[model samples]
Target: MSNTQGPVLVIGATGRQGFATATSLLEKGWPVRAFVRDPAAPKARELRSAGAELAVGDLDDEDSLRPAMEGVHGIFLMLTMMEGVHITAKGIADEERRGKTVAELAAKAGVAHLVYTSLQGVHQDSGVEYYDAKEHIEDHIRALGLPATILRPVLFMDNFATYNRPTRDGDNLVLALAVLPHLPMPLIAIQDIGRFAALAFERPAEFLGRDLVIAGDLLTPPQIAEILARTAGLTPRSVQVPVEQISAFDEQVGKMFAFFNSRPTPPIDITALRTTLPDLMTLEDWLRATDWQA
Candidate 1:
């Protein structure tokens, strides 16, 4: 369809990134079609109420995707690995299989621009399953010759709000992942990620064939701990937990930590992205507007 106003199909529209992206597109007056597994889900109902056309589809079923793609101009594709699957079977292999299938199907459907959400540090030879899976998807997207933009987002700022802080109970406390004190990490807000993806679709020609690293701010674990302390009104302490002990924390959490430790370098060009989208939000702005305490 040559009409620029055609709907954009968004997979995973009930989740964080998809919800944000769909909302942004609606606010910008773009017709949005959200692929959801269940039309009865609260999130799906909310999307419909917000003016998004709902399409029932599952990532595990390739045939269900086409109905959403019919006459669509662009798509935002994202897939989450099944929880508690074996590291080999559930983690990397599963992600690769699903991502590849989705990309191939999108290309076959004649999608004009495809925006694939990937992880930061995916291209580096990190030997991590999740990161490797992302790399595999990137490779497949390139091989398909689709007009695509790959967004490698930094660590989620919301992740720290959920997992890093100690429980409200006074007896338990948690610390940072890395053993090295003052080790810096790149982070970005999920809302900003949606904004970035919407802009990529708006200017597909500028973003096509480009791998954009999208990071909001850089901070050490200690700095993050301080932010938590200030935001939560607790005496949060920053301790350097040994990387090997990550598994004891949580299997998937540990694997993620190992991946982070393997490559402690930042990948995105934040300055260049700022040049492209000048109003990008910063961490301070996000925190101020966030309901962390609530």
Candidate 2:
């Protein structure tokens, strides 16, 4: 274990990626400063108990961010999209502007390493709002000449956990709106991404100025369904829904499917990542390790 000592500021610390990265950094003896919108939030308090210094900051408020970035060695920026039932185009623009502002601030603050969590297939000409928003941030990061590392992670396997049940209409696990039945898309667990981010902060020299597409494993929808069934001890079936059915599906789920089906994006190069961290977990391994019954 390398003895790296410096305060790393994590944005959106209450969220999945932020929480995981903060926990990982603390476990590895790194001083973590979490930029949370509400320090009194349950998650923020939990992070405080786990040895993280919480700083009140919102991505939209530039004034609030300076305090968090001051004297930080590195920053982990993961901008979350709006999950509201109804959001306007103006809302999206505001979110993207805030994210870009944060990147610019991190650069101006002279943070040694800026690790940004981006979405996969964003570089494609898909013109999806969510992906395009991320690309806007990435472009700003590159143009700013910051010592940055951008990580584009695929759909999280844990997305399955959000569905009500394994099957919709009796044993049929609804694979809604996904056109690529046999396409082996890449994915990484939240925990693994956290670990990878921590490692990147530690090895800034190697990772700086790199755009890494990261994934633990590549599996098709059917294969994923089989793995889920095997892990949960049930015979799950797979059903493919058309792209047009996306809007009718749960709005968020629909957007996710549309993103996945836009292109047959290839898996990321994990060779450098593997060299640094060999204990990365695959989907099967994660299922085995997780307490499904709980």
Candidate 3:
């Protein structure tokens, strides 16, 4: 592999963000070694078909990861809390352990660069358990003296297509979220996150030791609803769900929303980000590109 296009081992390669990163790297002519728990999985097979070499392994098993890290130019670290969305105290602990393990292994393997995808505002004490765990992992990476680029991405725009999708209410779609109507929420496409990761791996001098907060656009729920109506051809109504109601269902998600409401607005400069990543997508751009439907 060429120095600029060295092989990259992408953790969580079958997942949304990891798949994007791996695909972007391959598009840039960089070799990709996708670390996956199951090589037979559809996404993993897709990655292999798209020119990524599959490295079957689980993050929990250090031995499984060591072989994948061998001779890799860089590592893209993406860890899930509790293996999915539901975050418990034990889940938080497991997340930290997994993160620290990856960092430690990367350092041991003498990897050239490590790119970690952390949550936006995780540097601050959000009082959210999972956020705190991510911060701790960041600290561990720094403490290990790893040559790493930390990308703190805002909420994924893809969430609107799945997790926070609008439900049909007669002829109109009801977009109900715990966020306040007027509060501007920063969002980035999962694909954009991958694009940035590839850029970092290609140009380590500009990205190493840097912690970037990335966002494609900042829009309120109502504005997002409007975008959905205009871009996706849907009659959408924005409903601000009570935080308490969400808390009653999912305490972790409720705490996350409460923290979002606590902040007046997320701190992200899209214009500046555009200078770095010219193709950084806006809500409309994402909607049009994905052909998102309610």
Instruction: Kindly report which residue stretches of model 1 are placed more than 4 angstroms away from their true locations once superposed.
Output: 1-5, 84-88, 167-175, 233-236, 249-252
Instruction: Give the per-residue lDDT digits (tens) of candidate 3, residues 104-183.
Output: 99999999999999988786667788899999999999999999999999988999899898887776777888998989
Model 2, 91-131: lDDT tens digits are 56876898889888887888888899997877786656767
List model 1 lDDT by residue over 102-192, tens digit each.
8888898899999999977777777666777889899999999989999988878877667554444362234555635555788888988
Predicted structure 3: lDDT = 0.89
What TM-score, to 2 decimals, does candidate 1 have? 0.90
Q: What shift in Å separates residue 37 of candidate 2 from its native position after superposition?
A: 1.5
The alpha-carbon deviation from the true structure for residue 241 of candidate 2, after best TM-score superposition, in angstroms, is: 1.8
Those runs of model 2 whose alpha carbons end farther than 4 Å from true positions after fitting are 1-5, 85-88, 163-165, 168-177, 249-259, 270-272
Q: After superposition, how far is residue 100 of candidate 2 from its true place, in Å?
A: 1.4
Q: Which model, 2 or 3, shows the larger TM-score?
A: 3
Question: Cα RMSD (Å) per model?
Answer: 2.8, 2.6, 1.6
lDDT of 1: 0.78
lDDT of 2: 0.77
